[model samples]
Target: MSGAAGGALAGKRVMVPETRELEVLARMLERHGAEALRCPLVAIIDAPDPAPIEAWLRRFIATPPDDLILLTGEGLSRLQGVAQRAGIEDGFLAALRGVRRIVRGPKPQARLRAVGLGADLSAAEPTTAGVIETLRAEDLHGRRVGVQLYPDNPNAALLDFLRGAGAMPDPILPYAYASKEDDARVLAMLEDMAAGRVDLAVFTSTPQVRRLSQLAVPDRLRAALAATRIAAVGPVVGQALEAAGARVAVMPEDSFHMKPMVNAILAAIGTPGSGEAA
Candidate 1:
């Protein structure tokens, strides 16, 4: 999908709830002449204790699971950091290279590329169900599988599926979400949206949607979301927003990424010259 041209979104007020690439998303909107309301909802941090992560890395290096499922780019990146800090970066990378890497989405693929690696299998839908579907065709009986997980979710579904398929799943959570600190800011942003100040509210991760839902009452949250246009980065995020009683007005049909999401946003709210809602 093509991105919006410079000045396309002039006078538009787009609320961004991203954390990791808050500036990047803001600049993308700014480049399109939109005012970016930066309200980061969650902060990604390393696991509070590194001992468990270090142990996982050591076990991974020693055994080298036959299959490694990467759920998020941040998870892989965090694992890499933990491995480096433990002075086992090479061993970790070597073990990673030995396994067949399966990615849930393009982000994980991008992360793999950063480490001079690539995904051997990619989910068709970029969701947990997609991951399960992708692995369904494989011969996983008694296979050792390493699962990279993120914060807040234990992904019992994926683990149960793996166990049902007779695969031994070893899951590792290398990072955690620090979102409690941002509750006040997120609630303020919700109030802004409720007041019809925010033209569009963009969500890039499920955690952002969850955080908003957690901070606001259901009726109030739904009312606030109804006052503004909502844009989701992918189906997963879109589903999360929908489940939270918010309608997703904009989303990329194909590539689920930042640029595609920007393009979708531009399409939903026409350019300045088109005389749409800003």
Candidate 2:
């Protein structure tokens, strides 16, 4: 079959969850003839003080720590820029000279490799739960660890989880929020959804769900989300949608990638699938 025949998102009205992933996804949507809407729920920024992070790198000059955590691809990308701004480019490279980096998953690992940093380890799953599980198995209780945080500035849940799991190593957030930027299309997308102009909405991140709560979308627009067909790529995104009062229309098995998820949603819209209460 051709791409359009195999792609579920073909000609469907869709919503993008975050600005970071929008351009590429939007292009993909268009290639499939889908009318994609842009609505970024959160902004991602460089961490504060490129200096300390650079300094953090110095300690790794020789044999970098046995392990480091790469939480998000966005975080990893920002860290590189943060290092450059702090004039610690050389130090940053030295610190990671040969140390093994444990990224959240394939995407983050891909980012590392893109920057010439090879992955030491990558979590089996894409969620925080997967990261913790991998860390636990590696016995991080006493090892000093580095972490890249999420854009929303979530309260160090990973740190707490590590400590609770008997980890005593220092977990530093090196960079704080400096790369923050909201997706400009959020409100318009919401309006479209509210106007019943959208047939499907796709989400890759949960922050999009949280950010909508912060938007000034009228109650009617919010109600529109509840009535529209929604599809989340994974459990976390689905949970966030449900919490926001929008039921999930489809979450496919195994294929968490955006294109596949949309395909699954379209398949289900025409066939029977697991749909949450609206």
Candidate 3:
């Protein structure tokens, strides 16, 4: 895992906009001989109030939904954490088991498996549209679908799609994002991007793109990003960058994760056939 030997990303300066996995990602990049600039623009935390989540769990325990959709593994873990705090861990797990489960991606699927549960349906692509398209193939007429959501993104399209297909949609948002506007370090990072000091910019979530735009000024950020090699973790993140008018130059070919994304970044920088930096 050491980059003392020859590595594809040797001596590259890479910008990482991650919060929870900041140290892990930084270590991974450093292992590949890359100078990892750790800048987190947004911080995700459990919702200040747990009343809504508690209500959802109570209703779920009373009458489980016909289908449960998990969008993020973080949301699932957060739900369990809240349930444990409320002393309803066993009940909540039982209620979840009563209904069919659907996962948007491998992360949530892995989370379910960790809890001895499995997804009844899984999206081929790890995006909101992918979840909708995957569910469209099934018959959800008059069925109740409970959706687990993460911070910042509401994913209204999925709910609209479910309603259009004659299914009732219930959303449970367990987390919320608080901007790191007060952090002086973020301003320095923005200045670095503006000066083209960062060689490559890596994004794991759409909110990271929004946070950068908010802090760096969208037009200025867009201009600065033009010269930077932007690497999105997956299509959803790529779309977010593209929507913000940033050119996304790299993404994973198959699985969407930190290691795969690092390899994708290496490939984009002319190091084709490079494996995980770890």
Ranked by lDDT from best down, the candidates are: 1, 3, 2
Per-residue CA lDDT of model 2 for 1-278, tens digit only, reads 11244344455677766566777767665555566666656555555555565566555444466567787676666666766775666777667745568877667777877877778777767778777777777666556666666655553677897668665434445433321234356566677788888887877877767767666454754686875788888877888778787888888676466666756755676334423211
Model 3 residue 36 CA deviation (Å) reads 0.5
TM-score of 1: 0.94
- How many clashes does each candidate structure show, in the order listed? 0, 7, 0
Indicate the TM-score of model 2: 0.78
* Deviation from native of the Cα of residue 266 in model 1, angstroms: 0.9
Give per-residue lDDT, candidate 3, residue 272: 52
The residue pairs found clashing in candidate 1 are none
Query: Could you tell me the lDDT of residue 268 within candidate 2?
Result: 74
Cα lDDT tens digits for candidate 3, 1-278: 33434556776778888888888887877776678887876787889999999999888888899999999998999899889999999999999988999999989999999999999899978888889888889999999989997777778888889999999998999988887546567767766776888888889988888877677667776777886789989998898899888888898987888888887776677355556566
**TM-scores across all candidates?**
0.94, 0.78, 0.93
Models sorted by TM-score, best on top:
1, 3, 2
- In model 3, the runs with Cα more than 4 Å from the true position are 1-6, 181-183, 270-274
Better of 1 and 3 by lDDT: 1
